[model samples]
Target: MRILVAPDKFAGTLSAVEAADAIAEGWSRTDPEADVVTVPMADGGPGFIEVLHASLGGELLAVTVRGPLGDPVPAAVLKVGETAYIESAQACGLVFLPTEADGRTPRPGVAAQASTYGVGELIAAAIDAGARRVVIGLGGSGTNDAGAGMLAALGASSEPVKAMTSGPEGLAHVASVDVEPARERLAGVELVAASDVDNPLLGLRGATNVFGEQKGFVGDDAKLAADAALTTFAEAAGRKVADAKGAGAAGGLGYGILLVGGRREPGFATVAAAVGLPDLVATSDVVVTGEGKLDWQSMNGKVPVGVAGLAGSALRPCIAMAGAVQVGNRELRANGIEAAYSLVDIVGTEESFAHPARSLAAVAERVAKTWSRR
Candidate 1:
């Protein structure tokens, strides 16, 4: 039987490629004759750069750029043809910070002080290299700033950019925007924002309310920051930003991209098309996908769900194997997931983290064994 192994990164533990390898290894032990094909997937988040590089042949261009707090950091951009894939997390990712530094405990307050200047630098670099299109994967960011740092790197005035950080009532501070410098630098380039979430700029389900706490914003501060950023963006662009789809993504970076004439698309669809996922699924008899956690969010434009949908449309069964499966099996089944399996349920969490390879192999072996009887 032909099996397609396509899985998203297992968050802190394994990358999508590694997860696929582990599943393949375990399945091989059960059925040596199984024809397995592996395809690594990402949700346009932290692993976006690596996944794009692996799936689409690209050159890694390294450069020195400003980190979240204005510190110099080493970052890289992936270039393919006249297009470049840029992941914002490279410069301002939460992982860039240590749990403890200079004898002090780290806190989420650092996000407010972070910047996306480096991402802008990467975009500029791609433009200088003759790139005609720039695909920015927006997720796993570490800043709440309304892309002020990025605009700054592109020579936009900080006065108007800083207005985004002012209190909600001060949104009028952003009276005008000068895109002259940015337009000069990125003259004919098309910018595409590949975002994983569809949350708007402000509201209960918006950027700060839904994702700020994970990046460090909490209580009233989250709402305040989001509102201020959205208001400033709307005022500067002379349009409503609060209701814009994907506005809350990557701490309002989506709005910034939109302002720069960028188009927003589902993260999975972008990555999948880049990797030729539809063609792969069409030829496979069974498709297997997984993630670190499979929750309700997985149903909302995540890579695994996207893969399953593609596979189902081709009349193929899709199985999911995850570190933890939060949603009910019935819900998953209704969404084109034929079966759902978890490493946590079989191998225990401690053992899984300690030896993710072995734990994942065991999970795949169990899946193969169960399917062999069918």
Candidate 2:
């Protein structure tokens, strides 16, 4: 029997690579003779580069860039041939935001001020490395500035550059934007905005309204202010692409990319094509894909659902293993997941959270007892 294990990062606990390894180890315990193939997955989020590096064998060029708070942060660019892959999370992810005294809650007020200047620095590094094509993975962001800082760092000028380099709050004060220089900077390069969501840049389904709270916009007043600021920036910048699919991704970084001639693509699809996942699913007898959580959001172009689509197309049985399962079996089946298993169910929530790899492995072992045909 042959099994394919592919999973995205388990958020705070396990990376995509670690989750894949744990699943493979546990499945082997129950079916030692079974052939297991592991593939780590990402949806343009925190583990984007790591997963791609594993499958593409690229050169990782390390660089230091500004973080969301204007401090230096470590990041890397993956160069494979003439193309460069960059994870936006490395520069402005929520993980990098300063937290409160509790060490978990993101510090307040920063949400409205978090900047994506570092993302632009990473792009500069990629261009400097001779990359003719750049693919930017946009998700898990901490900023709500609509990529104003990114445009500034790339030579787009605004009245009082400081206002533009700052976050949404600052953009509200800016009067005009000149993006021609930024466009000229990428004259010969092809830019691709790889995003997990297809939201537009404004309105209820947009950036500030839908994603600002997680970044620390606490109340309706704060959200409204941020939205207004983003609207002001959008007016100054180009509003032509504000409604484009993925324009709201990574706090409107997708809009910024479009302003500079970048095209949008589904992050999972981009990774899948690069890793040749369709062929892998076609040859496998069973496909197992998962993530940290299985919920309504999982149905929306996340890694697990993306993998299920591939498995469905290939006529393979696909199951999901998540740390916590919130969706019922009926909904899971509707999404192409034949069956679903959760680590929190097999082991207690405490044990699962405290030792994710071990807990997940235990769940996989139990699943193998029932699913393994050998």
Candidate 3:
């Protein structure tokens, strides 16, 4: 039996590379002689740079950039040839958001105050390193400032620089925006916004309403204010991409990318091409893909679904192994997955969280018992 294992990061636990290794280990335990090929995947999220670096063997340029709360954070850019791959989560990820003084997780107020200034810094660093094309992975952000902080960092002028880059509270006070300097800074450079999300920059299905609750914009009042603040910022900038497919990605970081003439591409597609996923799927006997959770969002250009689609197109059986499987069997079938296995279902929630790699391996072993023809 030949099996191909490809998975995204399991959220806070296993990275895509680790998850693929665990799955390969367990499958081999079930069928020691089976041929196993492992490929880590990402959809422009936390593991974007790591996965690309692993597959492409790029020059990893390390740098320190401002975090969401103005603190310094370690980050890296992957420069392959003339193209640079940057993961935005390193600078403003939800995991980096600071907790309250009471030791509780950040609330809407704190999320509202987060910034994306570091992303601009990373882009600048990539440019300085002689990258003619920069591909920015936009997801897992902690800020809700509509990329105002990033714009400010990239040389966009506003009435009060501090307020313009200080998150929503300061955004509410902003008046005008000049993006000429920022545009000039990127002259002769190509920018690509790599993301899975397609939400607009504002309104019901937009960033603030669709993804705000997870980042702390919970109440109606808070969402309204956030939307209004971003609206004011957008009007000031005079850029017309609020309704663009990925304009709401990474808390409006997509909008900022568009404002600077960046084109949007599906993050999964970008990674898939880099990793030669299509060729691998066509030649593999069985395909296995996974992530932290298999939910409605998994259908939205995420790694697992994208892999499954390729497997299906190649007439190969595709299976999914996830930390938790929330989608129904019908949905799984609709998405081209032959079956879905969950670590939580096999080992329970406690063990799954405590030993993610082990639990995932165990699940893969059991799955192999059913699928391994060897």
Q: How many clashing residue pairs appear in each of the predictions shown?
A: 0, 0, 0
255-340 per-residue lDDT for model 1 (tens digits):
76776677889999999998999999999878899999999989988988899999988998899999999999889988999889
Over 4 Å off, model 2: none
TM-score winner, 1 or 2: 2
**Per-residue lDDT for 128 in model 3?**
97
TM-score of each: 0.91, 0.98, 0.96
What overall lDDT goes with each candidate model?
A: 0.79, 0.92, 0.90
Measured by lDDT, the strongest candidate is 2
Instruction: Kindly give the stretch of ten consecutive residues in candidate 3 with the minimal lDDT sum.
Output: 99-108
Backbone-clash count (model 3): 0
Model 3 agreement with the true structure over 1-374: per-residue lDDT tens digits: 78999999998789999999999999999999999999999999899998998888979999999999899999999999999999999988888876666544566578888889999999999999999999999898988887888877888889876766787777888877888899999999999999989889999998899988888887999999988988988888864888999999999999988988998999999899988999999999999999999999897678888999999999999999999999999999999998999889889999999999999999999999999995
Q: What are the runs in model 1 whose C-alpha is more than 4 Å off? A: 97-108, 160-176, 240-242, 372-374
- Candidate 2: Cα lDDT at 9: 93
TM-score of 2: 0.98
